[model samples]
Target: MKLLFLLFLVINGAHAATHSLKYFYTATSGIPNFPEFVTVGLVDGLPISYYDSKIRRETPRQDWMAETEGPEYWDQQTQVSIGSEQTFKANIDIGKQRFNQSGGVHTVQWMYGCEWDEETGATDGYDQDGYDGEDFISLDLKNLRYIAPVQQAVITKHKWDQNRAQLENRKHYLTQECIDWLKKYVDYGKSTLKRTVLPSVSLLQKSPSSPVTCHATGFYPRSVMVFWRRDGDQVYEDVEHGEVLHNEDGTFQNSVHLTVKPEDLDSGRYECVVQLSGVQEDFVTKLERSVVKTNHGNTGRTNPGAEGSGSSGLIIGAVVAVLLLVAIVCGVVIWKKKKNAKKGFAPANTSDDGSNSSNNTAPKA
Candidate 1:
């Protein structure tokens, strides 16, 4: 009887040792009615047993004496006691470990088992009491590091967009600056050429002939046109062509030469007109010969009365020349008198000859 009792104790202990696993799945469970057998096992929460499966197929069987001990004994002793709450906790802990290892954040959820009632053919996973179907698990991710090349491509595209915006702004600023510079350059050019437009006239020669050549120079040659107007009539044939000179500062200088005959010069009016571009400013200089003779007559013939006046001028020039000559002669005479006075006042040397004569005469006595 003692041996029978010991055997009974052994059977009970073997029944109690039977274990079942609670697996964590993502979306579905029970293998979709395919009868694909799935086994579950548990690992300890301790660091040493973290990855080690503690419950495996090698453990003792649960239904060894089920026929003899009755269904009540099997129900009480053979059934594993894995709670839904415990399995959910384990799965969450494992998920947290994975997140820590990967340096990411994620949310975890567990789906309990569903039940089907045969009378109504209705599926139910949740009721007032609890869930009855196999558990399904899921994770919602946040801050997950992507391992694909598409992630890098997205980052590069964002950076390029920012850079393009900056480049457009810089281009707009530079274009405005360029326009301002161009306006200033044009204004400065106009101001510099405006100062050069003053008219100048010079008489080249006047002595030998009555027909004197008068030259007129003007700035802004592109805007100026030259012609000779004799007594209010333009003489195109007799007008001399002018030469234009270009300056370094984009302005021009031109000279026009005109030869007027003695009779025309004395009788008519000659005008030189200078016109400016973009402006209505016109400059005119008039040359007119005087009817009254000025020392020399307009005909290039010297009048006798004018010649008498020229002789008087010559007499005055000779008087000035005589005075200058007299002053020079007086200066020379004064210099000679001072030199003679200096010679007369100089002390005489009276030593050797007088002393020798005196000594010879004394020796003879």
Candidate 2:
């Protein structure tokens, strides 16, 4: 009986502490057609470990690989993600079909980010789908779910009520996996002096925007602090802080934004400071206005191959659409040719239809 109780505690202990589990499943339309990706983030109240579907590798991988039980999840997660990828693609299509009989115009996506905090109980960082600048089939973790075409019977309330349990269970399962992964990593990191990935800070300014951003990336263990200082004292107000996001190679990045008036750019002095856990040293970068290209006009655009938001680049069936378009054009050409045949006129090697092709018999003049 004691052993059984202890086992229960072993499984349930993670929930009793301050932590978060966020599972992101996304499928978006794009070229090169790499659709469908699922990633899980484990936060022991601060970003700690991550599981990316594309690589099937978990961040803080060294500690995970050290565990005998940990390596098993590598193959297990890969297989599970592979299966979810198809389901997510279908999920994306469901939203696209809602707005468009064929599909949406640009890109379409279905995404879910489930994060549970000690204070908030459970919340979705983001739970929605975007189709051609419109959102549909939205689901919030706290029971505030509504579709865009809600009034028009897009999805009956009956079906949605039934599927609620299933969706919640899926979120729960991923959250449990996160708890296990984070607990193991925290333990592993403490067992030894873990090798550190030093922080790199950059002073940048966005295009067409007056905000100056201080970006810090490529650091490990995830217990990083990034802040802006103005000549010694901490500058609090007017500062925009971004979430800590994982890099492709398992490091973390964050950005702190500050807006400066055009005239005040030269007068105010600013610096970016980065501090990583387990490292006695800190990295500080001086903000240089001349070095940052604020007027370059394309700074806000994201890199396609970069670490964040890879979910927005998944592929949809462009080939089928292209084939359909070509078939329509061909049908139009054939119809015109048949009509010309009835008129006792057909021309080979015709370059611009000209007036001759329309009326080959001299226009009855």
Top candidate on TM-score is 2
Give the per-residue lDDT digits (tens) of candidate 2, residues 247-281: 54555566678776665456557766776765778
In angstroms, the error of model 1 at 176 is 19
Worst 10 residues of 2 by lDDT: 337-346
The lDDT, on a scale of 0 to 1, for candidate 1 is: 0.29
Question: How many clashes in each candidate?
Answer: 4, 0
Scored against the true structure, residue 39 in model 2 reaches a CA lDDT of 39
In model 2, the runs with Cα more than 4 Å from the true position are 1-19, 29-79, 101-135, 138-157, 163-249, 255-365
TM-score of each: 0.25, 0.46
Please report how far candidate 2 places residue 165 from its true position, in Å: 5.0
- Local lDDT at 115 for model 2: 38
**TM-score of decoy 2:** 0.46
How well is each residue in 142-232 modelled by candidate 1, as lDDT tens digits?
2112111233223322432244433232233223322232233223333332233443433333443533433333334234444446677
Which stretch of 10 consecutive residues in model 1 shows the poorest summed lDDT? 43-52
